[model samples]
Target: MDIKGTGAIVTGGASGLGGATAALLAGRGAKVTIFDLNADLGNQLAKEIGGHFIKLDVTDADAVEAALQEAEGLHGKARILVNCAGIGPPAKVIGRDGKATPLADFTKVIAINLIGSFNVLSKFAARIHDAGTIGGEEGGVIINTASVAAYDGQIGQAAYAASKGGIVGMTLPIARELARYGIRVATIAPGLFLTPLLMSLPQEAQDSLGRQAPFPSRLGRPEEFARMVAAIIDNPMLNGETIRLDGAIRLAPK
Candidate 1:
């Protein structure tokens, strides 16, 4: 769909992949709204990009609804919703002591990574469907963030992988159900990327991670992820699929 003058919402747009997407969408003339927990960065980035910012906890139902309402008030209902609010704190299911991981740790990941995505998507789709077609397009698009862990989770990635797997699992069914409304759903399974957190790592560690990618031998860039988002947005034929952005790397069990 044409992005110019359209409305879009990107969760966790304060930094990393989401931030890159918001910037790209705004640069393309779409009215963008950034939903993130980081209020200061969100506000700053919004000002820089000529977009609005809303502090939101994707896991909080009331807050998400309110945030969306606030966003629509500023830029109409967003037809482009990018789900990028997630966290991955790795821990083994059974440690050296043979103690099982804390249930809370696992649940928290699922809550934020999986349920949080659904929370935003369900609300966004409802509003988009209610608003009907957008600028002659059938409906809208929802891009979810997954991880290579979903396919080849390492030793400490059980929770993280499960959460991402939920996103992958739901893509097709959700797309088929929303087909009538013209809302498409897709996902991106990213490999190691030079996100801010990773950038802080020692150069040696960073280089090691980059070399893990077979051919490119480098971590993916945030702008590259943003470009993929744009391609997915423009290609209506791309739906209900998860495109692995990794450079031919199936992560080894750590």
Candidate 2:
């Protein structure tokens, strides 16, 4: 899965993990297309990195199809697909007020995080499959983003955890199925990272969260995650698995 001189598609490529990945691949000579809901950031990043940007909403099937068509038109059919389009608004199943959370909250999380990833991955893979084998040995690779919370969610994270859990649960099965097509599938379960969402917290709060990690206690760098993505793309044997990109941190119950 050499990235140089190939086509790659990264969902949610406007910011955070996906943005880092897009930059990494583009830097390595891949023709990257960013599929993101934020046209402003996506367009800015595209120009900055010399990649293309397509406004996309991963949860919409028709929009996904159309966006991929446009992306492939610009970059050719993508041999790399990274699913990083997700949302995590945490809520407790039972609040301290004694009322259970609204069912809509759970559904929204599932829709955007779980089903959204699948929607983009499946559509992108299908498009690339139709285009045929890419470089030499492999047709394509798919890297999905999960979270540490999938395994050890804290309080007020039932919806978020369940959504991520579905991603972890499906990685191996999807990999097995896609193996025949010379396509590899893997997921990354990141620990506490200083993504924009977390960085918005107070400085002390951020430090406190970082200190929770067992050793070398600090938030993860986006470049670090990008490098792991490159490693997975480079190694054909690293399929059907989810790699945890976190520090040695198991979250508390909270």
Candidate 3:
């Protein structure tokens, strides 16, 4: 559980929360590997952190396996895996145009956000299981990213909410299954965070969103999320649970 010198893999490490987690883990002396589709940013971040970067699409099983091998080659088998690669494209099931949301788009969201997470987690867990235990633990810890939308989704978030809800729903069972191997599973259901996707909105829109928070009245920071991740890694008893990183904000139906 000690992060110092531990091997860690972070999916979607090119930017946003994943990038922040990578930097924090590196700062804590963990040997980090970044798995992302953004080759340029991934490579740069790997260089900056003195770690490894694998250009990978988490949804591709073959690519995920190959990337895991590459990461193991660099830092041995990873003891910490963080699933942060996800997409949130907002659309109503039935829009004002009276057209139903495209089924393909909804499926894509689930593919990337839910199935993609499983792909990386399964690959990493297999490697860890094969390599055996570290520090008396059969494996390492896994942190998955969910969203507050999973609990209280605003309008036009059907796809995103379903995907994230799947993540939240999977936590307990996965943790129970991994316990024999000493692999902990946890999830973070984040509130409104100022990720690139949110930043692209008009400033006024951004301000309005921030004002909705119950406390501090602002978007969560990536570093704040990173801090929670570090805490989860260090605390052995924290397992099989989803922690909401929202500032006590129950979103209204938009």
Candidate 4:
């Protein structure tokens, strides 16, 4: 999709991958609305990019609907929706501590990583459906974020892996269903990116992880992921698939 003048909404747009995507889209002339719980950063980004910011909790259906309405008021209906809001709190199903991972912790990951994505995507799509087509197309496009862990989760990532796995599994069917409406769905399964979470590790540990990459032998940049997102949006044929942005590396068992 040509981003110029198009309305785009990015969840988790305050930081990390979502923030990069939002900035890139804005730079490409898209009218952007950042939907995130981080009011401070979201508001700052909105100001920086001349876009709107809506404090949103993706898991709350009613709040999401309201936020979408607010965004529409600012920049029509969204033609691009990006789901980048997720959490990865690692925990073994049965830890060495001899205690099972708490159900609430596991559930929290599912709620934010899986259900939250669905919540925002569904509400945004519904709103787009009501608004009809854009750019001579039937509707809009949605890009969801997954992780390599979904396919090769290490020992301490059971809940995180399952949640991301669900996202990867649903991409194709969701795209197929939305295709008739010209609404495409695609997913990005990123490997060790140099985001705040990963960068916080000690330099040696980060270097160790980077060395695991097969060729480039380094961590990914958020901009690289944003570039891929732009490609997916521009190439109409790319749909219903999860593309790995990893640098030719399958993770090791932890």
Best by lDDT: 1
lDDT of 3 by residue, 66-137 (tens): 888888888888899999999887898997889988899999999999999998998888878656667776
Show the lowest summed lDDT stretch of 10 residues, model 3. Answer: 129-138
lDDT of 1 by residue, 42-112 (tens): 99999999999999999999999998999899888788999999999989989889999899999999999
List per-candidate RMSD values in Å: 1.0, 1.1, 1.3, 1.1
lDDT of 4 by residue, 1-254 (tens): 78889999999999889999999999999999999999999999999999999998899989999998888988888989999998898888887889987899999999999999999998888777656676577489899999999999999899999999999999999999888788999999999998879989999988999999997898888888898889998999899999999998898889
- Cα lDDT of model 2 by residue, 32-129, tens digit: 99999999999999999999999988899999999888877887788888888888887888888999999998999899899999998898778766
Model 2: weakest 10-residue lDDT segment is: 128-137
Off by over 4 Å in 1: none
- Ranking according to lDDT, highest score first: 1, 3, 4, 2
Most TM-score-accurate candidate: 1
User: For model 1, what is the error of residue 233's alpha carbon versus the real structure, in angstroms, after optimal superposition?
Assistant: 0.6
Question: What is the model-wide C-alpha lDDT for candidate 2?
Answer: 0.90
Q: Return the TM-score for each candidate structure.
A: 0.97, 0.97, 0.96, 0.97
Instruction: Score residue 95 of candidate 1 by CA lDDT.
Output: 82
Report the candidate with higher TM-score, 1 versus 3.
Answer: 1
Q: Point out the higher-scoring one by lDDT: 1 or 4.
A: 1
